[model samples]
Target: MSAWLRRGTAATYAATLGVLLLGAPAAAAAPSAPAPTGAAAARKAAAPPASVDARLFLYNEHGQAAVAPGDTVTFVMSTAGYPENVPQHKTVVLELPEGVTFRSATNQHASGPCVPDAAGRKVTCTTQDPVDQLPATNGAWWVTTDFSDELPLGEYVTAKATLTTEIPDPEQDNNVSSWDVFVATTGDMSVAISAPPGPWKVGDKFDATFKVHNFGPYRAPFSLSSGINPVSGLRYSGWPEGCGFDPGEMQCTFGVLEAGKTFEFTMRFEVTEYDADGISLTPTIYPGNQDTNAANDKASYRAKIIKPSASPSPSPTGGQAGGEPTLPITGAPAVPLAAAGLSLLAAGAGALLLARRRRTS
Candidate 1:
């Protein structure tokens, strides 16, 4: 079995609290208070006694909860939510699924030895000691199993585990847990990214579209995982739901995509500071199912960052390059203020001379 297709895991926590009245109410001695009503008394009498809560779960190395044939998997059975200083009648039972052979089991938290049946199909671990030590109510066991190489592809199998106590549990739903494992098949999964064209300048915001395409012979079930790298100069401004993010990386998971189908989403980014001449948004994809093509698994979109250009020095004469010097007019004339004033003064002098000549005539 290939490493990527070998393992997937599912884990969940369960807690059930049974309240016990260890002491009487402060007002119980008050004679003036009325006694309990008929229904209240009947209900109180019918209530069960307090007991320790126990939960069971099966876990694997990876979180996807899947497995492939011929793969050896180690499952961890964990017990939790057992109150302190309580008597423990703890017993854990594990049953193997078809086509899976049990190898071994070990106790981690309890004092009991794990005993497997003659055929290795079932195992039991138990402890009779009361939980005297603080936090001693927990139990954990490691169990190993191997999938027969003859197991067919795309087969879904389930392994069962249960935790039990001598006393009845307040919540029975969590006492047993089942881990679902799937035999994955290869589906050619690939990703492509499209970003707004740049010269992207600082303070500019844009959306990048990511499309995940499954060029398949099989459906990519249980979704897919993608890593969108945040290159220099680009800061994440917005993210779609169903994704997890960290500095410099964004992780997203999409639901099942059928063969030849594509899943599309968008992420908003802003150009904050430029660390290089360009930024490349490269998103790589890993399918929950097996994938054979590595070449098309990732795609990149490159954008050139536009650096701040130096402000042009004030033209020596306050005029733009290759253009004539612009003159400021005092009023409506298209001439310099000084030149217009001089012309007005000369015209006034000529008018005065003409008046003198007319008087002489």
Candidate 2:
């Protein structure tokens, strides 16, 4: 009986250990190693390669921001693109104001000669090529217009330009440019001449100061010429900054004078002869481009230069009725004195000749 009990307890302990082992969870597996990368897997996304752009600007030979009537403005049109075979509409449209007209236009890629034609104030520049090659893409067109005769102070003539391309433009800001050129003339430039102080002496140099005033409305460059009267006996000796003596007139140029502005210039004149009673300087101003009034364009001024008074000669008798007691001429005859002087001059000449001949021999 004791041996049977011991065997049954050992069998129960073995069964419980087997049940515990079966109920426990399984251990986790090892982490996986990554695969090697290739060239195809390393590539990144990129932007589109093909694009075109257009820009417009105004230019001139002298690079001035303002323009007057009959002035030319160069409209520079530039277009460039990468992978350039893109079918695009490259154009520049000029929206001008009233009183402005298109003069001419040229295109390098034009199929035929560019004879610029315009409809009123709208000017158009567009390439006709279906697929425009970017190599011959840049070009310019010249347009001219007449500014108003009179413009208000600080006002400018304006024109709008729109540059475009059919393809996507990387820069959309520069596609639109505008021109604001000032109309350079607004008023009449009136000038006048003033003669120097009068009663000048003959054979003396003098100066004539001129006061030029802008009487009309706008600012303008002026060319002034003073007509020198030949009878005035006043010869042009020198002139101030903008003055020059051209043929019969003393000419000078004043760049730009604004309204209510005054410019002073001095021209020197010398009295060449006596009897210079009514010397005059007639000045005429030719304002730039246009002039409003013809009547007031010129004015006259006069000056005087006279000969000095003559003094009375003293009497040979010293103002006495009876001349001082004088001894009769007791000297040799004038003919004999003259003969003696001639004989002495001949002897000196002979001596000089003898000395030269001896030196030569």
Candidate 3:
């Protein structure tokens, strides 16, 4: 063979051997699986964790009592844990009602002067110490907090607060579970009258004072008037100050009375005739926008007056000298048999005497 042909044959054989060796290894090795997508990984990470739910309880220490405007009120918070292995530690926050100011907090878990938020809006009250170890079944803790004198006098003012627990998991912290509590304020009123001494004589002029008080949550408007039972001998002479009156109609208007406030007015009456019977003074209260007749029907108080006794009248002649000892007899007419028999006997004797004298003549 020629040298060039031998060199070509040798080079071709070497190239063929190199291709076989590279292809055999590539075929033996398999392609690795693609990495999982971010979404799939996240889903796996988000798989629900094994956890226990926590619980809490809240109550009003004031017995859900009512409070008037400008009155400070306190509420009590009670908390507890549920389930065996759950240790609970939580933070609490409260949103006070309008017209109320924060006063003080007791049984605080943490220390430092706590106050309302910068806007003077929300209260930033929180528990200082952690609820270390909770009872297996049920355990509890409580605290009382007071509000400042900022309440407006009114009905149905609401006070509210919330309790929350932070749940811890390996993946995340501060998972919160919460509950809420609420309470309201109180309202009441008292009414009375101041008047002249009794045993009122005929034609005597007198005046009476009526006082109204607000003992409850807010202020209320009222109407005042007087009534007389003709039989009671009690009559109203002039309507109360600032009041308009007709013979049988009395009407007066009183504005609002703030909680813990009072108002008074005067009324006049003249005793026209002597009243042997007793009398009664009735004073009533009416809410705003109510009719006078309807208001009088809601009388809050009724007082009575008794007239002094009068001298006794003399007995008639031929009757009992004194009022006592006089007995009343009631029956049919009666005849006396003995008196009739005596009259008949006398008439017969007179006839006999006249006949005897005639015979003698």
Tens-place lDDT per residue, model 2, 1-361, is 8889899888898887766676543222334566535521232123334675545564442343456655555544444445443445666666776656666555444322223344547767666543333322333445454454454444456677776666678888777777665566445666677665676677888777777788757666677887776544667754668676765578786677777788886768777776644576888887653567767778888766676789899855333347565555568998999999999999999999999999999
The estimated TM-scores of all candidates read: 0.62, 0.40, 0.30
Candidate No. with top lDDT: 1
Q: For residues 1-361, what per-residue lDDT tens digits would candidate 1 score against the true structure?
A: 4644443211111111111232344345446766667644543455434776767787674656456678877767777765533445678888888778777655455446568788777878676344433223456667788888877665567778888877667888899988767766776888888877787888888898888888877666544344433355567756666678666667776556778888888878788876554767767887756778889878878777777778888745567578878785355655576688999999999999999999999
Clashing pairs in 2: 186-217, 186-218, 187-217, 187-218, 188-216
Ranking by lDDT: 1, 2, 3
The superposed Cα distance between candidate 1 and the true structure at residue 249, in angstroms, equals: 1.5
List where candidate 2 sits over 4 angstroms from the true fold.
Answer: 1-101, 104-186, 231-233, 275-278, 289-295, 304-361
| Candidate 2, position 344, lDDT | 100
The residue pairs that clash in candidate 1, if any, are: 8-65, 8-66, 9-64, 9-65
Summarize candidate 3's per-residue lDDT along 1-361 as a digit string, tens digits.
Answer: 6999999999999988877878967666768687766644443445332543444344455543444444455544444433333444454455555655565554333322245665443454433342332221123323334444554333444545555555533322222222222222334555677676565666566787777776645455556665554443556654446576555445676655676787876667666665554445656665432222343234432333445467899975455666556565545434556677889999999999999999999
- Candidate 3 TM-score, C-alpha based: 0.30
Q: Name the lDDT value of residue 126 in candidate 3.
A: 39
Worst 10 residues of 2 by lDDT: 39-48
Instruction: Count clashing residue pairs per candidate.
Output: 4, 5, 11
